[model samples]
Target: MTESIEKIVAELPSLKNVTGAWAVTDERLARGDAVFLADLGIALARTYGSSRQVWQYRSVFDHLLRLLATTPGRDNAVQALRLVGSAEVAGRKLDRYVTSLLASGHEVADLTAVFTGQASEELRACLVHELVLRGVVVEETPGIARWVTSPHWSHHPLGRLPVRLSDVESRADFPNYGAHGSSHSMPYGPLESRAPMVIADARVPSVEETTTQAAAGAMAKAVANWAEESNGRIEARLFVFAEPLDAGSVPEALLTLGLECLRGAGKKTELSVTACAPAQVWRVLFAAASSGGAYNSGSYGAYGRLAAWQSMAALAGCPEGAAVSEVEARVRDGTWHVFDADTEWFEQVAWDIGVAALAPGRRDLAVLAATDTD
Candidate 1:
């Protein structure tokens, strides 16, 4: 068996036929041959650059993850994890595997153990970020707390705050901020056909034309990853008014801003709005920023959390080294009034959604609308 595996590894570079390679490996993996799979995983990792295509095979990647989960030997598990990490599966596939490993009781330290050497710290921090975004209960050790709460990580939802296992469990209601379902489908309903009321002194500015560079930068970062992955149009618009809007007019302002941002995407006649708590708003922002708008799937990589925090800080105009409590206080005190809106449009497929924030005192509003058919 060892000789045959070695032969396959040696010939992998010259092999022209993907089917032949799959046939041999898939049959053995189906038979639960852990030894063969483990040996293959190690050899592949040692020569990962050349054997890259072999990892693209789903069966091989799945088998490697299974080995990582069940292998008793720490060395074997580490090797399996390294191989899995080296794979180039598109989108959030790699993240799903990491989530599964964490689910199987593997600690963040256990996974971080594989990434040693000079550049490994960033990799470890990224893994931790992804786990937190996916709603995994991470034990906040001193090292992890520092990594998450560092200035770099503060813009993300849980970054500035202390990470608690209980917080992870309690946040199960995070998705309730917006109307989402188990089917992962967009909530589409009839909208009242009403044109936006043009308030006399209100001004809706293009994202690029925002008066605050920090605000503009934050809005841009918020939708950056989502725009890339969905290959969709995402508009982040800012509305500035001369005076604080009355409670009665907040919804009207949001609807007017939403419609303008959503202009080329077709007509959305009605608007459904729901008020969200500070925590809920932060979670939605973190999820959208971290996971490219597929927050429910746990399919995003490490930088999502980093980008989330940076953007939030920019949006809130947090000073350097601001305390977590201070930032939280600002959010809670209505420096940013958050809400979820469902504009009855883009029913074609997944991830057509809208969210906005109103800074009443600043007389500023930010609206983000995203649509993707693919």
Candidate 2:
């Protein structure tokens, strides 16, 4: 990857500008922000021992770079890049370009030109080319640079197969989670026109802190509002992403609290509860599917959604059909169960499929070998 990046920088005459801005990025990364480092570590860990994951990481890294570069000027871009570049991905720095940007004031001016509206078409092309070579800028349209994010663990082993009919969306399209504060939000996809949704941001002061009554009250209010507007059927799916081992009882308590509140509201509420590791997309899907609700697994969540969707789609025996949704609904309706002590076995199978997708001989084609029945 370093060799590829070097080759790109060497070929682009306007490389001076791109390199200088990256130097500022390097300085920021060296400071060691905890959150940034943690995210970087997860991204890199998933990619280790698997080339497919490595490419996925690269795609996301490049997408992040383009976003930082889109900042109005050198300083802002530097700040944005610093916010994301702490990861130890290969070829993060453009060696010669960084040296040139630091040593020559004239080169810094050239780099500034591209971001500050002083660049020529040729220079812009050169910068764009360098980015493309590194997998940062996926496409360029005149003044616009279209960026892309690689799938996260949420979509995993399935690759990028779509669950819904209108799934042509980009992964980099959602608002940043850091921007939304620490509260939880709802409606994993389009309200489905059928499935009731509730996402509880149950983060508390500590593991001993119980917010079951408050969460139940919130859901009751939501159910009441929805009941007045709709046909009055309240089928609520509660997903709890809890942090502590002892905290597992919180979701259990909510089930009782939720049922009691539903009785008062005079509405029949089919409540389904799922508790899993905090901040994981798999648990969210686990909650929805295990509860017999429809799971979208769209661009809004992590990388595992895509992979899960693909695997479910295949297991349902309909590659191009809406079988993924059907299976989710079945799981919600108590027809299928996707979690247990055996889940690790399924995950291992999925990971093998993913590794095979990046086969050394033919990486371009999407092929899954057939099983013999003889």
Candidate 3:
């Protein structure tokens, strides 16, 4: 028999490399399979936002992953994930279904068993109804499943039009650096149907000067003029190259342009910032997320383009030889962060326009003098 889970949990973190070995092992830790175990490990890595939390969860997560993988089949996996997602665990729970299976003598009913045409119609209909509510279409022949539309569509403020097939590519030129666009616009209006519109990228002298009240007001007027004459919908993207330290400035500049100028007063616009600096990737992500903007790195068409995910994987103490593609896949599959990939996660988590109002501010010497300086 394999070592007890307590001992394994205690020893797993000390192993220099566990991902590869874990992938091949069927060693069960709370009844999850190998695949489930690896995914849990990655999720634990991403669970903690701080470095200290990362270290604290390392061993517990490693041991938790030693459980078996997620249960197979679409309906079964969904039900299993939902159950565990609701259950509380110190580390990620791989497959709670298996735990139930071992505990209940196979009495628990599942959609997979009902599809054989042996189960009662009432039971099968109940499962089918649930899948329909989830917007999933299931085929009985091959047991295939597909989404009628992305469940994520309504979750994003921009609504559904920005789906993958409709993404547009355009370009902009700042004085010093060139920008390429990866944009998506809503299809509800003629203006958004413009496919792609070219806009000049900002070439500010420095980060501190990137955003200012005057500049924001000027851009707001321009966006207002565009919105007044047309059906209201806007989306745009631009890229910039800067040192990692200065990269945070790009999104900040873009935020002021989007938030202060056009986003309020019943308007919607999404402006994305793409950069090349690996070091500044996370900072850009947090700032963009904070301001309800979008950010990414590398080519939009290319794989392994997100520097934030790459950096997060490293920071989470992922396997030494892990590939960018592997990390990216984990990001996509929700292995790393609770929200999964920051690229898409940020889009959904963006701050709502008008939720926060800008408060009055004072730069005047009179106001400053009135304040206690002594």
Candidate 4:
């Protein structure tokens, strides 16, 4: 963990380039695997806004890992990791499918056609190996497996395209020092910036672009290494997508960029990047869910900051329309402050009561915001 922290500090530039640069982590409270990923996650969290609860989940996972590892009957850190690692493994599969489609210029879900006869578990294992050695394909999104890129698309002797392949390589912990972002903007666009050639049309000057690239590159490397050392037995991959320079709203964009960066790993993995921050992606996801008190039910790509907003909004009973107006009124009246992650949980909890917008029945939401939220 110390080594990871040192590495994280070294990669601080790239870590800061993330959209939630203001985020923080309590490494002292973390341990085990979660502790290992904390610095990198915290670094990314700062650039990409994240909830303290989500941040705390690292501790939760770490605690579980230690317990699993220490179990006397039949210690099975590997199997117990299934709780989190299984989800990660599934996510990697999603990456392979999406990246393959994008690299081959296939449409979403349409790529499954390529597997009509060949999409076997064995083939998937082989494809996983391929993605481990090449670094050409470029498409990544969070949780959702959508792909884009053409690392394997080269003209054949007959002027025909041969088997399209995506390349990937892993040199985790790349560092960036000069990245810059002030006010925060989320990165959300359609599949226009496909793989092997992702270009964010940020309306920034040349110097800012240079700094953003620098920061982004550094963050990419750190994330890659973290994923490499992470629960690899579970089949995991790392990706990093680019958001508009310093776009504060970073939840979705961060996850998307993370997927893109995974292709950088030396291997041919089929994965794709779905462009969307959180509002649209997550709200829609909730719309598809089976419950309101869903845990980790939202898109891993976006909605990282929803914990804070949802927490405060519920505490104050602030509804969407009139509540927003009331919150605005409070701000104008100096009765409330901008949703700040500047203090302790107790402070935030106490402040919730002062806001007149919070109403009944929303404590469930607030409970999630504080305990199971994020």
Give the lowest summed-lDDT range of ten residues in model 3: 365-374
Ranking of all predicted structures according to TM-score, beginning with the best and ending with the worst? 1, 3, 2, 4
lDDT by candidate, in order shown = 0.48, 0.28, 0.28, 0.25
Over all chains combined, what TM-score does candidate 1 have? 0.62
Q: Judging by TM-score, tell me the better candidate of 1 and 4.
A: 1
lDDT of 2 at 58: 39
Q: For each candidate, what TM-score against the reference?
A: 0.62, 0.23, 0.25, 0.18
Candidate 1 per-residue lDDT over residues 1-374, each given as its tens digit: 32386676677666555456555555664565645665676565565534446644333445455544544444544544544554433224454444334323455555545434222343445566456645654455433555554576555443444443223123322221110112222232123333533334444333223545545656657456556665556566666666666544555556454354443322343334556564555555555554454433433334444454455554554564565455555545554444323343343345554555565374666665655554
* Number of the predicted model whose lDDT against the real structure is largest: 1
Candidate 2: Cα lDDT at 277:
22
lDDT of 2 by residue, 1-374 (tens): 12223333333333333443334333444443223423433344344414553443333344334333332344433433233333443221222122112212122333433444433332333343233322333233233332112233223322232222222112212122221111223213211132222434544322222224433232222122223333222322322223331232332333233332223221122222233221222233322221112212122222223333443333222223454456444323221211111112112111111000111121111111110010
Residue 104 of model 2 has an lDDT of 22
Error of 4 at 333 (Å): 29
> Stretches of candidate 3 above 4 Å error?
10-161, 167-374
Off by over 4 Å in 1: 1-3, 10-38, 45-59, 66-76, 82-119, 130-214, 255-259, 262-268, 293-302, 315-324, 335-348, 360-362
Please provide, for model 3 over 1-374, each residue's C-alpha lDDT reduced to its tens digit, 9 standing for 90 to 100. 44443444445445676553343334442244434444444444444423463353544443332232123333433333332333233221122212322112212233444445333232333333223222333432233122213353243322211222110111111011111112332111112221221234544332222333432332222122122333222222212222222322333333443332233312133433333222232332222221112222111111111222333343322343465455434333221111111122122222211111111121100000000000
lDDT of 4 by residue, 57-111 (tens): 3333333333332232221222222322232222443333222222222222322
Clashes found in each candidate (C-alpha, N, C closer than 3 A): 4, 19, 7, 84
